[model samples]
Target: MIPLQRPPLPEELVERMSARGERLPQYRGGARELWRDSRTIRRELSAHLVAMAAGLSRCMYCGDSEGTSIDHFQPIAMAPQRAFDWLNHLWACAYCNSNQKRDLYPMDRDGLALLIDPTADEPADHLDLVLATGAYRPRTAKGSETIRIFGLDRPVLERGRAQAYVRCRSMLRDLARLAEHAERAEAGAVAHALTVQPFADVLYEMLRLRTAPRAALVFGAETVAGLNMLKDPRALRGPLHN
Candidate 1:
């Protein structure tokens, strides 16, 4: 999972959502019914979410598979009042939304939610990714709950992430070579490739660990050099910063 930026919705849409939330009868059934009936709200909101999602509308939790549902970060069963609240909404895959998470919302003793909200939290802070294995190691309770709730450690996802890591490293090497040869256009293309792939967390983690204690040993000298090349704003600013 990666940190997401929640763009401001259109003023009209915001007003509509607020009005709908206010009219919801403070019941789970009411929230469900309203969400199901309001086709326009669902359509417009989902479009914006898809536009912001990584790699062709990938799931916000798993970062794999198409995100086809609107998931409430705080479940409607627990917080019906936030059913239409923009901040509570997230784009998710059908598996993560319906099969894994459902309406479960575990909380700590202080009443804070246990699950990690990708938009509000930096996932790397709570979870560490093993690039070679594609497994997530939980560094905090929130990370543990997120993995459990999303089934992020499933074999297929692990395999996919590991594959993505290999591909991203190769692309980075190509990017570094392109940069060395003063091929700015080709370098930009390679950088864009890194951003548009599935399991974007792989590339993100590689970049994050570029300066770690044993980065050279983990990423290899060529990949480490490639990562260093990315430090120049001209290298990845266009694709990554956008």
Candidate 2:
């Protein structure tokens, strides 16, 4: 998972959400009912979430399947007060929301949640991506819990990430070549391609490790050169860096 920035909601939308949250306790039908009742607000929220999501509205947790649900980061069952809070909502795929994560939320003794909030925390700070095998190596307790809760190392996801790593390397090489020829249009197209694919963490990890010791050995000299080419402002732009 990469760090996600939550965009500011309009005052009107924020007020709507706050009002709904305030009335959450009065809803005899509970959070689910109230959530379903706000179809218009939900639709608008979903649109903004998709706009902020990586690569064709991919799940914020897994970054694999298309995000089809608006999940409460802090489960409504556990934190009813945050039921309508925008900060507690996350764009997620059906599998991650219903199967993997569900309502299981683990917290530390200090009352801090163990689950990594992609919008609030940088995932790389807690979890390390093993590029060679496409598995997550936890660097902290939070990372371990996040991986287990989200099933980040599941076989399908691992396979996809492994494949993505190879594809990203090839794309980077193409991007470097295009940039060398001052083909701004082609380079921009390549940059766009790099950001739009699934398993975006693969590309992110590659870029992160570009300056690590023996990075050339890990990503190969040519791929490392390509990764370095990203420093050129004219070579890449837009969501690739964001």
Candidate 3:
């Protein structure tokens, strides 16, 4: 999963939430079964959740890039308090978020969240996508439970992930080779280019698995590793001439 940048909320929007929080009755549900309430906080949050889901147009659960919907990674039945928790709300695709991740938040707190929080942290920090198996590994235990809860490996999701994984790894490999053989300036130039404009955007796509376009993972890891190494070539090369 790629790291996500949380968009800032406008002042007016924040005020609306604040007013609602202060005036509304306590949310009577948990994360699992809040959607059924049509007259309470659950109902109100459901509208926002649906709005967020509609806004994404892309699935938050599997990054399918199609058939997006508001997905509750944790069943609405189990954790009702999170019914309106903004963080708990995710825009998902019909397949991954709906069919696979039906109320499955590993009851064990051996880890944190099962689904990716496009707001809290970067997915790439803990998870790595394997192209062949369409699975992810938390480079940590916390990530493992997160993966299990969200069902990141549904057949459709896996295919999308695998496609992207292969593509990204391939790009990184090419960049790495250039870094090793190209002149210092040339290497730096390429690295800098990747960090900005198309390069950085492309990397972000690899980093954010929940939204990456399907069939884009035909790349490899060498280039990605190379870019990581090229971080400030002068700092790296300065030590070599001595």
As for model 2, its CA RMSD to the true structure in angstroms is: 1.6
Which sections of candidate 2 miss by over 4 Å?
236-239
Model 1 misplaced stretches (Cα beyond 4 Å): 26-29
- Each prediction's whole-model lDDT (CA): 0.87, 0.88, 0.50
Q: Give lDDT tens digits, candidate 3, residues 16-107.
A: 54554443345454323234433454444444544443123445444545434455545556654444445656655566665566766664
Q: Candidate 1 lDDT (Cα, whole model)?
A: 0.87
Q: Candidate 2 residues 1-242, lDDT tens each?
A: 99888999999999998888888888999987898899989999999899888888999999999999899999988988887888998999999999999998999999899999989999999999987789999999999999999999899999889889889889887877887788868888888877788988888888888899999887787788777766556445543463
RMSD of each: 2.0, 1.6, 9.7
Clashing pairs in 2: none
- Superposition TM-score, candidate 3 onto the true structure: 0.52
